[model samples]
Every structure is written in C-alpha cells, then in structure tokens.
Target: MNLTLRARRIAAIVLLGVAVTVTLLGVLLMIAAGTEDAAIEGHTGRADADVVSVTAGRTLVRFHTPDGGEHLPSVGVLYPDQLEEGQVVRVEYDTRNPDLVRVAGRGATLTILPVVTTLLAVWAVVSALVWWLRKPGPLHLRKLRPRRIAV
Candidate 1:
C-alpha cells in the first residue's frame, strides 16, 4: 500500500489542478447570475411571453417589448418553473436589453442550490482521490519471543 514520494507529489499536483478548475467554474456561475441580477435591477419591464417549449432544464419563450420588437433571450427563459409549452407567463426583462428575461418572481437566487451541490460533489470526488493516492503501509505485528544466548 505504500506510495512512492514521486507518486504522492504527482497526486498533489493533480489535486491542486482539479481544485482550481472547480473553483473557477463556481466563480463563473456566480458572476453570470450576478450580471443577470444587475441587468434586471438597472431597468425592468414586464410582458407575457409565449412559451414555445419547456423542459426541466430550460424554457424557450417569445415575447414582445414595448419598443415594438420581438426577442428571445439567447440563454432561454430564466427560472422557468411550472411552465408548459404554449402557455403564457409574465416575465421581467431588462428593458435596456430585452433579450435578458426571467419569469416573474424569479431571480438569481435560484442559481445557488445547483452550484453549491455541484461544488460539494466535486470536492467529495477529489477527496476520495487524494485519500487513495496517499496510501499507507500495511500493518504488521512485532515478534515477542526472547533470543537465546550463544555458547
């Protein structure tokens, strides 16, 4: 079960790389959520968008702004819960940028649960890998018998 020093060092390096990658992904998710929050806060408007399709992960909606232009947010509808295809649901959008839209009463808060869960899962996997990489030596019992004297 013993691991060579070089193997341990390599494991440490790989662990560090994985930690950095996971951290970066979490930060990026938070930043995107914050940006959407800011956009909503800066200028907000409401419209009943036509739901073109709905799925557990995302929803597609088509809505018209007061400026007389139809737009669909490139990222699809935000916080599109309990929605169905062909249903009309009110949404809050960044009037300055109509393409940024979220279902009414939904905001960046929804992003927290998924991101935290993902981080926890990643850490659990990395921790297991680290434990396996730094293996310990097998147990052995010492002899208890006394030695005989030489003639």
Candidate 2:
C-alpha cells in the first residue's frame, strides 16, 4: 500500500470513532432539551409561579404561564445554595404551551450539541468514502534499457 493511503486509512478510522462519540453526546443533550421544554409548559393560570421549595438559592415550584398549563419546576435562582424556598421568581415558559417552564430561559444551549455531532458525522462519512476510493501506486512498471559497454 502507498504511504499516503495508509495514513489516510488511519485518519479515517479516527474520525469515524470521533463521530460515534459525538453522536452519543448529542443524543444525551437532545434528551435534556426535550425534558427542559416539558418542564416549562406546565403552568397556565398566572403570569409566573411561586418557588415552593428552596434549600439554598435554588427553588422548586410550579409556574403559571399565559397558556394555562401546569408543571412542577425545579429551578436555581441565584444558586440553590443562596435563595430561599417559596421565593417568587420570574420565570419564562412556552408561549404556545403553558406547562413547559425554565428557571432562566429557553434551553437553546442543548441545540449546539446535536449540531456539532451532525457535523462530525458528515465529516466522518466523507473521509471514509475518500479513503476507500483512493488508488495507490502505479498500475504498471516501466522497463529499464540495457547499458552499452564502455571503451
């Protein structure tokens, strides 16, 4: 095999492995995003929910949004260690649905994980194809001519 082909094969394998790892992480993050979405969609009667439980700065409670759905949400205000339980804090929820809620804002952060994983997956597939299609070395050998005798 040509040195180039060999090196490329190794690289392709590494990229494929990285792609799989990234895909797994993406799956986990996607799940987290869905869970967060669900949490905020629960309360519908009021503008915001009251903090029901607080150990420190963090609180757990059900929030009321414009949509009129309900959910039990656990959120950290300043931090779980700093805020008191039952402290009322303004939280954002889904506009279309009321039950979904969050302590801070929408869980848009989780979207990046899947996007990066998808990019890695595409890169891995392309690299594997390139490595597979590569043709190394010459197809045939050239013949050498005979040398003339010296005087």
Candidate 3:
C-alpha cells in the first residue's frame, strides 16, 4: 500500500477509537445518573434549598434537614437547571446520605437527552471522517500515477 492509503487507514482507526471512547462515557453517565436516582428514591428527604452558586457543571445549595441541621452537598445538586444563586428551590435527597441530592421532581430521565445527543453527534462526526478517509477517490488515484514526458 502507498503512504496515503496507510495514513488514511491510521486516521480511520484513530477516529473509531474516539467514537468508542465517547460511547462508553455516555453509557457510564446514564448508569451513574440512574444509580443516584435510585439512592434518592430508597430513602427520600425533602428540603427547601438555597442556591448558593451555579456553574456549568454543578449548582451548590444549602438546606436544612428536618432535624434543623444544615447540609450542603459538596458536589452540588443534580438536575439543577435554571436555578440562580440566592434562589430558593425545593430539593429531594437521600435521607441516609444527605449529600446525595437532586432537584425535586427531576430524575435520571433528564440526563437521557444530553447523553444520547452527545453520542449521536460523536458517532456522526467520526463516521463521516472515517468514510472520507477510507473512500476511494479519482483524485487520489491520479496523484499516485507517475508523470508522463514527451521527448
């Protein structure tokens, strides 16, 4: 095989690897969200939490338990969309582990869209790149041919 063909093969392999990695991450994300939801369902607690801060990844909240003890989940609340700092919002948490908290009425289902879309986007891009790399082209063939000269 020529250098171009070998290079294309390598690139396709790399893109396939990236797709596999992304798919695995998406699956893991779904599993984690499901697990957290399960934990909250098993031993549920309700509280009105004060949104301390909101970042792209997490929303920090401080809430008081039934016993009047204050708790703030270090990793922040799950499914905390549309919340702003200093806002009060209802939250559900694992009574046994108060640190495990999420926005009330929101569950693992909320994660499905983002994960599925991300996987679809990654696969689409990777498939296109791999196809472009592997597909045979007239231009590519022409480039491999030797130049002709008239004496």
Give me candidate 2's TM-score against the actual structure: 0.37
Which window of 10 residues has the lowest lDDT sum in candidate 1? 134-143
Model 2, residue 144: distance off in Å is: 25
Model 1 lDDT per residue over 1-151, tens place:
2357677769877996997798789979988988997898789999989999877667899999887899887679888878899999999999988888999888887888888888888888888777766665332345688889999
lDDT of 2 by residue, 1-151 (tens): 7777787677777767776776777777777776655655543223555777766444676664444456674443222333456676666765654444555544546476657768776777866665564545443345688888999
Give the local distance difference test score of model 2.
0.58
TM-scores, all models, native as reference:
0.78, 0.37, 0.88
C-alpha positional error of residue 53 in candidate 2 after TM-score superposition, expressed in Å: 23
User: Residue 123 in candidate 1 has what lDDT?
Assistant: 84
For model 2, the stretches where C-alpha displacement exceeds 4 angstroms are 39-89, 92-151
Q: Give the runs in model 3 whose Cα sits over 4 Å from its true position.
A: 137-151
Q: In order, what lDDT does every prediction score?
A: 0.83, 0.58, 0.93
Point to the candidate with the largest lDDT.
Answer: 3
Candidate with more favorable, higher TM-score: 2 or 3: 3
